[model samples]
Target: MSQPPQPPQPPNEPPQGGFGAPQDPPPGGFGAPTPPPADPFAKQPPAAPSTPPAGGYGSPPPPPPAGGYGSPPPPPAGGFGAPQGPPPGQPPQNPAYGYPQAPPPGQPPTQPGYGFPQGPPGQPGMPPQQGYGYPTAPMHPQYAAPQPGGGKKFSTQMQIIVAAVVAVLLIVGGGIVYSSSSGDDGGKQDEAASAGTDGGEGKGGEGGGLADGTEKAPADTKSKVGFQLPHPKVTDTTVVDGSWVTDKAYVKTGVNEIVGYDLAKGTKLWSIPLAGQVCAASRHMSKDYRTAIAFQEGKPSAADKYPSCNQVGALDLATGKLLWSKSVTSASNGDEPVRFNEVTLSGSTVAAGGTSGGAAFNLANGAELWKPKTDTNNCYDMGYGGGDALAVVRKCGSYDEPQLTIQALNPATGAPLSSYNMPAGVEYASIVSTKPLVVAADVGDTAGDGSSISDFFSIDAATGKLIVRISADADKYAADCGSTEVEKCTSLAVGNNRIYVPTEEHEGGGEYGDTNEIVAFDLTTGKLVGGRADAGDRYTLTPLRMDGSNLIAYKRPPYDKGGQIVSIDGSTFKETVLMVNPDDESVREAETSFSTNYAEFIYEKGRLFISEQMVSEPSKSSSLDDKQFLVVSFSTV
Candidate 1:
């Protein structure tokens, strides 16, 4: 379960040999992470591009590498577990992975995406300092122009997975600033109350919001920066994990309040004050733009660095109002309200679970539906997965040897209609989907790559039977589920009775660089569906969410290019470019800055909004003049 070897650097660039040379893979362990070494290219300047090609931004990609995914690299000296790539800090020695590539003699430095840049070499004797800044001028480049194409060929050994990272963005001076206006239309605010239809209880959890998340592709996909929120300075790491988009506004969690912004213009609309910082937010939004959230009981004090996350509430996204906020006491924990770890929405119910146990309430008025009780067997509901159907992860037995039961619950009565017992030695399991009842877990501490999955359990939620068990090799697949948060999984989309995942990045089929694909696995048969959507040379695809049966995926930008959003057909596996961000180095930097794993990505209609899940004090390397981004929005015309 060691980290897979890093792919070889682009064949074109010379290797940087020195103190940060490749090291053996870190000791293998399931939970412990090897500290990343100093980034060798931290001070490196950004490479420049050469002359722009006449084909322009939307030009077709070069022909794929000769063999496609069918060509697999030879195994490492020590086989699959051998450390791959450079040790954590050392990126592959290639321009594609951010290393500078000097152009042929006599050529002037150009921009990155359109052409290669050439610069003078480092002075004699001094350890070469990698250059880091791109040319100040901006250049626009179109992305994967839509075209008819056949499905990408796949390797029999290839598996599907998705990976994302979360990081903060540093906005320097003279950057693009979003203009804001007041979103105070009282008439529209009133109409927001009845915006969504009743989706009715027990249908399933995946369907919510406009189009049930099936955003229509706009005719024009060209996009530019619509707006941005300067990162808020904070005393300590503060959680601001909630965000929702409505027809009238883009709502998000601020320090201790919920604020709404104009969806198109990034204007300030309205705010709803909360008792404390938001700790957990529901991924599901009611059709009417209503959602659930969990927050701290009070603001943190010097004496108490972190307060208990005990409050549960519902927010009316359209009107910008806190419909209800309530907490409950566990019989086993006496009078204090239970501190919940996660919250979710199921029809009219708001469910929250924590160490103290599980509880539910009416989504409309916060009326208590059920609360945890003292159990003779010490069984407690660890948490829940909510949406169309409500399911609970109930833990029983003793702390040393726990037994987990995944139960499909009655959203109205809190009764277990069906249940599936997990295998032994499985301490934590995440519900990847509730209605389909897919669960992911690192069975026996086998997935050593930090992705909390070794296998997937496809269960019949209506009958409490295991339909299929898909074994996922950590090194091959890239999906992840939070080790502790039952409902917090990303990089994979479940639809059409199949689980779609991206393969971990690998050497590509083109000369450009690393690439990945989106593949599907049958939920009922536990077999690969033999279809893939290639990210195409230098691009890596990460499944964001589903839009109806279609899968919406984000293509991480290559070193010199801008990022892309594409919609893949559920049946055909063909990709249609949705929004192609500008390729200007600074814009690409700002757009791709957020770590994929921790950032909140919401793409709808033709707009993509990326926000931080938590914010903290700036690092020592940060300058006082540096501005952080709270939420950056992009839109297509």
Candidate 2:
């Protein structure tokens, strides 16, 4: 930042499209849904979604086949995401991936290239379907009910709010279905509603896979028949993060409220309103996994040059009652708001770090533990992994330290455990996976802005010694980031003591790219296990993780909606494509790189939860409106 002004992209990190990190721009978030703050349910949430004949919950219907949530609704006559005629000024819907970069054959690139993926216009003979393409505004929302006298009422006691979404529900006589629309230029909009019948006739399935090839969960898991929670309406930018503790879901329902719902019944178990804004990224849980710690970013102060009001609070995950709380301090880099950069816990010790510095507190009663010297030593970025081991980089672009030093700290005492020094010429380094102990570094060309990852290293989590380094013949980190795109810092994924890397030749034909396949290497040995091929010539796929023992990667469709979730066998690399995309193509497209995606997908306790972000950007702004949040859960049973 000091040498010379590089091309400045948006400085502020958008919500990791799904549940992501601020410094990283992967849609949902930076860190994958590994642990805390990643998935709303701390560890595991509820069962699979199901459609039972009035007997959906308590009795738990007969189990479904592979991929829990039942199959698609027979691929609707027009296929998924097929638009139903447009609203009566909007240009004739050009069924194509609306990416601004590679404009449809005849259309020009949208102004201000943000580098997001765009969809191609409809093919000559197929129904229009775009997955991960340019997010387009739906033209079918803002519903109203007739008034008793002369006008319709929106908030009157007489107004009955029956449906929160009415976009698409595959399977006519079974799942919920309705259409919605929004303003074209990003103005105020609403989701359409319909007078849907409560019950319908449809056979519950043994197969959990949808028609489009989304994965199916186990038979014992329940399939999602409908949405359980209300769309989260947030007034601020606080992300609606969730966690699972004791068979319940701890979800942030609003700016000031965090609610715990009984996953089995979707019933309100408890609700805890924070004293300050809950920073989802600062989320942590104790060694016993009973208490949940989230940083309460207090209101900002106007006096200081760099002001922030932040605190750390712990709550009983089960009861939602306050356990303890204490104020926190950080090391500052003036002119920027002091935000908590990282949070971790070891035993009963709680630690946090920021641009300012790092501090530790007792987890039980929220008393000061000690102020360790984390800010000095040429390190500013603190990351945690391997459950409790805290990793910090020596040179975090703070003072032009030539080489990068990697150090492991005893989170409880903030004492050094193990340390390694990376060679010079490294511009940036990030701990990609803690479980597998991998770090990704961006060693930029000294003379240009062109950047690509320089190497991949496996370090000893306990000893902090270098074990293996792969700088060639490996997948370079996928450098693409977006408001809704997955994997902000793409490069690697770790699952079951194995590391998965996608080849560098996958994408970049246009906004979105494809990967030939993901290559697996033994976690400790760094030996190649196997490489699986992509489904098709341009199937854009990114590995999410080795979900359980099965490697799960998302096959990003070319369009804005209708992407497929596929699972690959870790051993055989055999892939199974499941019809799991929850976005109906009518939701808000994640638009700009700074815009938020419509939904963040998280898998917990065998069930898949979709956290829907605002679909339409508020007019006059190109970012998330931060006024809406919705969590839809699915399972296979």
Candidate 3:
């Protein structure tokens, strides 16, 4: 019913507080307390259909002014509606480009390419992604704090670890380089060290590098030629002419015996026989080579103790005829036994020493020249010093404290020229050489001590002045020879300017044993020269003669099986072994025995006359009884 028009709702009434209530401002004003604000920008409702207003309302309120409509006032200049400045207390935004907001505190900053999922509240940004879909893992608990100082400290620690690792690698690399370099030179260093040790010259003229220096080759290059044992044809059995001439020829002493043979063809030249126990002929061919000195031990058929007799008989060189005969007797007494050890002839004078106690002789008349008194009953050795002068040695006392006196006597008048006293308790005394000077060796006592001492003296033959004296330790001279006892040093031999002394091995307080050695010493200076001559058991040194350039030595092998005639170069002291027994092999025995196997050697006219006595007998019997003498000859080319 439209009776009275409903009065229009007052413009300023309070808004109802219920569902679908019209939302309008209260009449009080904008300052009054208000409900929460609704979303202003929400979608607007659909427009309503056009309707005419009442006559009075139809006039619709005059249109509101443009500025009077309820609209937000124009935003203040440079506020939200316009290009405004940054908010208070915030940095200005970059005009060039825009980037995501920085992550909240304690979170990693965002990266452009990293796709991060939405994170929980408080985390404004997403978790960072890793390469190959791997999520960004959090730092270890040890590094959870995001301290700026801690980051710098961690960087320093990393640098130190990296530097340390690099240093260690460099050290290892240096070691490898050094080892390689050293290994490359190791062989050359060893070779150089070895070369310095060995001398330069080797055997056979080759070069050997020894520690010392190179040894020069010998000046004389001739090889040594060995001696040959003569094959003698036994035609007559009772032949006693086994004596060898110094000229390498033999003279027979029995009837129907071959006297001489062509050494090259073994042809018999002459035959003769004579009665004698010992015989010696001269080597001088222009002189009387047929003149032989014979010593008959006893009367041929008498048991009567006749004194030993010696005869110097002359014979024709072409025919076997006695030219003259002379007899010599010991002046002491008829009962005084006479033993002849050696007979020497100088020019025309003949001299001989007897085992009974004297030296007497004459070459032409066989008259008693002079007899010297020797205290010892045995005259071990005698030799002519020069001219008619004779040197004699005799054992005076016991073996422990033996007295050895060397006396020089005139053979023509029996006048004592000089005498020298040797050391006491000497086992042996030998006159080694008589030339510009006389060399002698007196071996002293060797008992409980480990070594033996030898006193070497050089005395003037004319004045008997002690020119030189030297003492040598026997053990130091020979290694295998134990020189601790009295040894029979009869093996002493002398050369032109040298003396060779033999030393044998012996145990302390034991009997003299037999390991043999030959040591050479300078005659003038007494200095040791060449290497030692080791003949094993075959060490017997006999001085033959001194030629122009060489010294001859006849060395008997050990055990006396045979011997060799060696020629030593006087200048160089090199030896050449000229003779050796073909059947003799090295043998050892426990007993002391004399070797009857004689290599009778003599040097004259630049030739060596060697008589090798070959005896075939059982070892039980005496080798002297069944002796056979064969003569051979040799010469240097």
Candidate 4:
């Protein structure tokens, strides 16, 4: 279970006996990060022409065409047990214009066809979900850009089995190399339980094989047969957010509506109605991808009118079959503007509803397993704590000085297994991940005076126990959480026994040097890994994911100068720019803004899927931009 100790730093002056002193190492002991050394004056975009993102993370490639996760995880250990690279001679990636080589030809069909069929359990002969149309043209390809190069390849024998020290990941071995195929994709999902990290050099957990990241990546590349869908044109509503459920991408079409489209061959599968925006689908959730859950926003059903909204539903992600949908008994006013804050499932428990209140239900049938202990408290904001537990952040204490409480509940039965009462000064907190560890943030911890408590903490998921606390100013996990002290940064990926957080450290100033922007920390020690800064330096970058052995970053400047998407070598921490963004005035305006209209990026099947963005212009369904919701898929197959 004991990991090799962190290498000791060599003395500044090497011993005289050593053969000629080793050549000075680059920033990461190899090539330096991309974009050249950070230039403080007159910053311009990376010099390169690139096709605009048709869309949208792995650096190491996947066998699943270009996209990642083409196939399911190797079967779990016992009932649930555990959890790639290119070769030499062949180029690790395509060097032409940053576009990946055309993917192979095995991409799966997005759906059967353009027709919206009555999904799985729609009233037997029910009419196809009404008012949905399909796209008929081919958009641009979401090319897979070269992200980080493989750090160092490990032996094929090296596997990331469950370790005792909270999933102590031995990342150096070619065990986790850069995807020779996947390359830079967008976005990442939180890591689930696999390695152990509670005590000294903990080894493997031998936990269920749900998500140990040890399973072999797909061998077959996911080829994208020419496919594109027009942006959905709805006046009353807009596509807010969505998830890639297996082969199809489920997105919020409009008010209380969701539509699924095949990313492979541009097929319109099904369109289901929704009540509101509170929605959650098990996208990268290994075997849990079968179900999708969302809150029914808007006025309550005839059965319950006391609360303006009180309905939650779950459906089969692929089949469109209804798993279970229920309305809750609430004391809320019908006029309250609220939707289920969190919708998650653990084991057999399906939980949907808002932070105000929610319940865990039976996955087999629509049965309420249990509700939160108190209505005044928030619902399941705390995500699933690895297995059958769900973490919930609730408000307790006097309103003027409310206290934050986190509860780990039994997903099947709303019983509190453990609860952590956060310190008093913290009024509100949000949960980022429950696995690896319970990471929560007190977003309200911002004040001019240093006394203001902007704090972030990690806790033990199984028990209501606090692990470590850092200044929220130092590292606020939430990207958009309002904080002026630092440039906005988000923790993009969690893997290999570490959490990757990228920040530009942009605190209102043009005086910026190439300081380490991306931060990777040990999941257990919470210490900077490798005693080295990230490879994202010299350029303003947004950390995306750990592609293969590299760290992919999006060089989307807030302005319109056409930026580049680059990757940082994991081992060397060297940066390489892969794709470039167009700098035309139109492209700049659309991408530079902090508008809520920004497209949602999701990773599935090795491909990065980007949903349509909310545009500034009003509707004219005939316009390609408004009429259809755009879904672009990228890969490095």
Selected candidate, larger TM-score, 1 vs 4: 1
Error of 2 at 175 (Å): 36
Report the poorest 10 consecutive residues by lDDT, candidate 1: 160-169
What lDDT does each candidate get?
0.66, 0.43, 0.37, 0.40
Off by over 4 Å in 4: 1-231, 236-239, 247-255, 275-288, 297-308, 331-339, 353-355, 375-389, 447-453, 472-478, 481-491, 505-516, 531-540, 543-598, 612-630
Question: Measured by C-alpha RMSD in angstroms, how accurate is candidate 4?
Answer: 24.7
Give the CA lDDT, 0 to 100, for residue 212 in model 2.
Answer: 29
lDDT score for candidate 2 against the true structure: 0.43
Q: Give candidate 2's error at residue 399 in angstroms.
A: 1.4
Residue 11, model 2, lDDT: 34
Is 1 or 2 the stronger prediction by TM-score?
A: 1
Best by lDDT: 1
Local accuracy of candidate 1 as per-residue lDDT tens digits, 22-120: 121112111222232122111122354575534454332232354443332232343221223566887654322222233455664333321122223
RMSD of each: 20.5, 21.7, 54.7, 24.7
Q: Rate residue 482 of model 4 by lDDT.
A: 16
lDDT of candidate 4 at residue 533, scale 0 to 100: 29
* Tens digits of per-residue lDDT for model 3, 1-637: 0011111221332111001111111111112222221212111232553764332321212212334211122323432112336789999774211212444466664442222233336643433222373222223344243476654233322322222223222222111100001233211111000000100111222211111222222233222222333224432111122344423344433322325654333345565544443333322232555343435443334453222444444454455455455555455557544444334544455555433343555555555566665444433333333322355555566545556666665656756677666666655454444454443452545322322334567766677676656555544332111121111122344555566554333111111113333445655555555444333332444445454445555554333233444554554544555444322221111001112112334544334444432222223432323222244444432
Q: What would you estimate as the lDDT of candidate 1?
A: 0.66
Best by TM-score: 1
